[model samples]
Target: MRLRLVALAALLSPLAACSTVSEAVKGPELAPVGYPAALVPRDQSVLPLASAREPLPQAASANSLWRTGARAFFNDQRASRIGDILTVQIDIDDSAKTTNATTATRTSGMTAGVPHLLGLESSLGKILPGGFDPANAIETNSSTNNAGSGQVNRSEKISLTIAAVVTSILPNGNMVIQGTQEVRTNAELRQLTVAGIVRPEDISSANTIRHTQIAEARINYGGRGDISRVQKTPAGQSLIERFSPF
Candidate 1:
């Protein structure tokens, strides 16, 4: 019986040796799910890129426009330095327009190759106010264009404020920022100054132009809004109401 068992074991060993081993190695691998890559985080407190904020359309606001703030804003005497107390005010009003009758286009917003700094100077001193100076001006000439569910509200003037400490000035006249801040002008102050500047391209609707002004103010933020009086949420509205978009 022992001899017979040994013979059977030898036969099984030879049969096992006759079988071939696979050259390809097999291992566990992962399958990719069809999920998209993560998106970047955003802070909605500020304006979003490519969002609808354009200068006022068709309806003209003012006539006198100048790119420089009193021409003094860019003067050598006006160049500020660190520790200088710079009082900055942003404004929109009819007085800020500049226009030439030679380049005037009808109110259709399709310009006949014209230029304006948020306004047409032709209207300045000629028919509209003389100059749109911010420090001593009021913005009270906004007109509303409402169509169906989309209603656009324009303040005749909307002014936003920003400030910088002037850490350093580049040799070629670019001012560096030590620290800068933005301020929300009083609602009373912005009520009438809705003059939006028409830059190289017409990217401003009266409202968007206003919004761009606010973004510029952020270059060097000034300070926080004095919104302590404002309730975190409207009275009688639930906490959910503050965040319920759906």
Candidate 2:
């Protein structure tokens, strides 16, 4: 009995370890807050190594009040070069409703008869069931009906604001920006990420741009930790649901 118990324990140890490993693999671990390195391009440099052109010394005009390239008290703060920071406004409000109905019906009938066949009709009447008519030798009728109805209603809305850093600049003067924000409440950690391309002209004077202005935009908002894990279905259950034919 002692040997049997020891062997059973040994066999179950691997199964317990496998279950622990599967749980760890199913959920994403909370990431520490830091720069989103994945959004940066490998070939491009985040900061300019040197100025495109050396700035020429502006000769002081003794009589003029304004100098060359000097703006009136205020300056443009829009993001135009790599390494610049700008705010992105995301406001998504969408709703959809669809209904479909299909109905089909068909009916058909066919009749064949042999009233006379070389004087054999009388002989067939005696062999066939009583009250059988020669005029109606074969008759068939069929009907089919099909009806289907479907309805769908969905709605989604999300509003947020995040600051993003310019990662790269295109030849067309567009800038690619990416940002990640993380917040931890107790054990749960919420993460938000945004990345996209935007034109310099679309940026407002306040250095903010709407989400719609960003082309090829990608936004994700989710959480990791105890709460999220509880909300998600177990890995084993999810696998069975996905592979089950019924």
Candidate 3:
């Protein structure tokens, strides 16, 4: 019984050592769950467009038609102030088609012979096999043909309306805008983000502007859900594949 107990202990010792070694190789463990909300920090408040060089006038002159450099009437609803919200119309319809074809052919032939050098034809015939003409001693022929064709056809269209906030006013009076919209259904979340600079004069009378008018624009639309997880590889396996040389 004592010998049997000793044998069992010896068998378990290697497993314990292996577990320790595996833990060391793995280094640190990650959290089992992820917090999607913590991906980006939330802004508590909007920042000013620029620093005020001088205090605003306490009161406007009575006879002055313009009040404190106002560009339009007070009733105009155009977006001119920081933190103001405006509607942005996103309409994108794009299509492209391209085709290319290439063909190449190459052929080469080589022949080497010695007719009669130093009158050694008889000697060469004796050394060479019968009907083996020295003129055709070394003849080679090669042909190569290559053909390639490629085509691309793509079309995309997205139409949506999103409300954007005036994040900042540029020195040239352009407005920097940013907008985000998120929709949640069941366990899925779809997010859309847009940011860009727009000229104030380009805004329509209806207080809206098309996405095409935006400069340096960035748009993103995607979703995260069960379907997304199904399309993605496991995190551990993805890491291994990325680091693998073969």
> Which candidate ranks first by lDDT, i.e. highest?
2
Ranking by TM-score: 2, 3, 1
TM per candidate comes to 0.24, 0.62, 0.58
Candidate 3 per-residue lDDT over residues 158-181, each given as its tens digit: 998899998776554567788999
Query: What alpha-carbon RMSD in Å does predicted model 3 have with respect to the real structure?
Result: 14.5
Between the candidate structures 2 and 3, which one is better when assessed by TM-score?
A: 2
**Residues forming the 10-long window of minimal summed lDDT in candidate 2:** 47-56
lDDT of 3 at 43: 29
lDDT tens digits by residue: candidate 1, 1-246: 999998777655543533222211111222321111244243212222222122212223376343322233222223233333333354546333333333322322221322344575344446546664433333333344433333344435545543334333323222333233433577311111111112212122121222342221232212223453252333334323322333
Off by over 4 Å in 2: 1-75, 112-138
Model 1 gets an lDDT of 0.32
lDDT of 2 by residue, 85-175 (tens): 9999989898999999999999999999889989898899799999878899999999999999999999989899999998776544567
Candidate 3: list runs displaced more than 4 Å.
1-48, 51-72, 114-138, 232-246
lDDT of all predictions, in order shown? 0.32, 0.74, 0.71
Report residue 122 deviation for candidate 3 (angstroms).
8.3
